[model samples]
Target chain A: MRTVEFETIAEAVADAAIDAGRVLPEDVLAALAAAHDRETAPIAKEILERVIENARIAREHQMPLCQDCGLAVCFVRIGSEVRVAGGGIADAINEGVRRGYERGYLRKSVLNDPLKRMNTDDNTPAVIHFDIVGADELTIGYMAKGGGCENMSRTAMLTPADGRDGVIEFVVKTVRKAGGNPCPPIIVGVGIGGTLERAALLAKRTLLRRLDEHNDDADLAALEAEILDRVNALGIGPQGMGGNTTALGVHVEAFPCHIASLPVAVNIECHSHRTRRIVL
Target chain B: MTDTHILTTPLTDEHVAELRAGDRVLLSGVVYTARDAAHRRMIECLERDEPLPIPIDGQVIYYVGPTPAPPGRVIGSAGPTTSYRMDPYTQRLLALGLKATIGKGRRSQQVVEAMKRHRAVYLAAIGGAAALIASSIKECKVLAYEDLGPEAVRRLVVENFPAIVANDIYGGSVYEETTECSD
Candidate 1:
């Protein structure tokens, strides 16, 4: 059996959190450049420039990109033959999040209770999702999900009769309603088929794809491009101030669903998308 | 925008009048910070017959919940939050003579109407650009509601703080023109 130390995982998580918070991924930067170049409105172009300049300032100063440093979401894929050799997996992950937020000077946005509303102070209890695969590698993926964009996300259950056109229409309408609230030139992550929860999870997982990458499934890739086109045509543009660049990308992930159900979820992400992965 | 306007805060109606939708402005002077939690508290104080800790008349309110300042910093990343959450309280503040408010996103119809009636404007700071926004802030201090932590009301002195006039008194909104939707 392959053995991995809990503290080793913790250390990697800590470093990844801090680095991800400060730096927008390179693919995301390239997408911003393209959006700036492709934009048709003077105001949209100026907004894109400010966004690019903001990234430079955040990196140069070693500061978090936004005040909402985001809730730490860790996706862990463990090998069937591998075993964690130290503390509990959840504890290790939370400890890493606490250390990272503390050391990096990122904001502690988590509260002890959603209703009672007391401060957690250390930004603990990161949301962790685990998947098991038949391999000897343990891969940890981290995403910082800001509430502004998360609040703009939505899910809908459609009849199987609604078909592909329904999926495209719903995503476009949802983004149209979101307007400037989610901070446009946004990335739209779409999950199709599956049950309600799985569709939601898959939508979020699709967001992990690099901005330039297409879906492995050819048909799904075509759907992604079509949805991207329609959403941009809505003219929500950068910051919804109007332009031709409403969405940077649309990522769709689909699986088989029940005959009667077609579940769809749209997880919107802002331009400051930050994600990182470490393999052990 | 073909031109960038430089403005000072505690803004006058005349200053606000010069602004139009899509105009880029560099603001130098003081702005007060308030979010959902603090706005509720200020409204409560008004109901209880208490004077506001900060003035609203001829003032610009920035909707932000800033991170804590690091060892040698005046403020942490202090960018605008989504503004709609504060919409319920906005009309009240506008009625009390708030000159302008800065945030990101579309606003309620009532808010647009109030801005038109009050001769105020709605400005948008780049939403995700917190570190850059903090760089423009020269000073910051908690004015009230420190218990709210990041949501506390704070007074900030900033220079050349960049923003776009998203909604103007002339009934023009950058979002409306962009989205082509009436809401």
Candidate 2:
């Protein structure tokens, strides 16, 4: 059995949070470069160029990639054979979030209540998802999800008869409705075949995957490609100025479902794509 | 590289009138900030028939809640929030002689109608271009609602701030241009 101290987890989370805020993920940067190369519209190209430049400045100066700083969504995969020694895993994570936001000068955007509208100040109570796995290790997947792209994400419960084409249509329509609001060229995460909440979670979790990677299933990969093509065709280019480039990538995650349902969800991520992984 | 145009603010109605959707401008000079909470309070003051804390005649309002400034910096990374979230409150503000609004994304239909009627324009700063945008801000300070932290209404002096006209007084919308081009 392996033992991990609470301070170790807290330290890792704090560092990852700061690093993620300052640096654009390499995969996302490469994806943006690819989009810039193919974009024909001069305005869209300029927008993409500025986006790349923004990332560079953010990295070099240690400034946040965006002012939103985002809500901390932490995915914890804890090894069944490992034991946490110092404190609760969640407490350590919240502590880390506090230190990260405070120490790193990141914005504390989280509010205490939806209706009451009070700022939490430290960005605590991170939305943590835990899973028990076989390896003797702890891996944390972190994303500082901005509100604009998040607000644009959508979900629909399609009948079983709706199937593949229905999914594509819904995804395209959602992107069209989203327009420039999510900050194109956005990454699209699709989740199919699950219960309502599961579908949403699958869509969000799929965003943590590398943008350049594809699903193992050939059919799902093909679906991702098809959806990507259709979404780009919407002509809602970067900042919706009109061009061939709209989405940077489309990632689809799927699961088996009951006979009556075809639940679908689209999680939109802005070009910032601030995600980091910590292993301890 | 596409050409970048420059404009100075507290923008005049004539300046707002000339802007077309998709035209890029680098704005300089005085502007004010207000987000959801500050905007709500401002509107409530109007409803109570009290004077606005800051008179906004022929001025621009940026939709933003900036991160805290680190030691020595005049301000922090300040980027525009999504505009539609403020659409409900915008028309009323425009009626107060506001000439322009700067943010990202499409404005509501009602906001567009108000812009055309009031001779105002909507400009978009790149959504994620906070650090780059912060470079143009020469100064910032809270004018009211200090308790809101980042959401406090701030008076800012910016120099060569970059943006593109997304909505214009001529009833043109950049959002409309994007969808129409695909057809």
DockQ for every model, please: 0.63, 0.59
Q: List the residue pairs that clash in candidate 2.
A: none
Per-residue alpha-carbon lDDT of candidate 2 for residues A1-280, written as tens digits (9 for 90 to 100): 9999999989889998999998998999998898899988888888889989999988988888899999999989999998898899999999999999998899889989999988889988799999999979799999999989999999999998888999998899899988989888899999998799889999999999998899999999999999999989888999877888889899999999989999999999999899998889
In candidate 2, chain A reaches a TM of 0.98
Compose the digit string of candidate 2's lDDT tens values, residues B22-99: 788899988999999999999999999988767688888999888888888888788889989899899998998898
**Fnat per model, in the order shown:** 0.65, 0.64
Task: Report how closely model 1 matches the true complex, as a DockQ value.
Answer: 0.63
DockQ of 2: 0.59
Best by TM-score: 2
Q: Write the per-residue lDDT of candidate 1 for residues A1-280, one digit (tens) a residue.
A: 9888889888888898899989999999999998899887888888899889889988998888999888998888988998888788788889889888888888888888988877788787798889998978789889988889999899999998889999998898889889999988899999998999999999998898899999999999999999999999988888888899988999999989998899999999998898998777
Query: In model 2, what lDDT does residue A43 have?
Result: 81
**B181 Cα displacement, candidate 2 (Å):** 15
Which segments of candidate 1 are over 4 A away from where they belong?
B178-183
Q: What TM-score goes with each of the models?
A: 0.96, 0.97
Alpha carbon lDDT at A109, candidate 1: 82
Cα deviation in Å at residue B17, candidate 2?
2.2
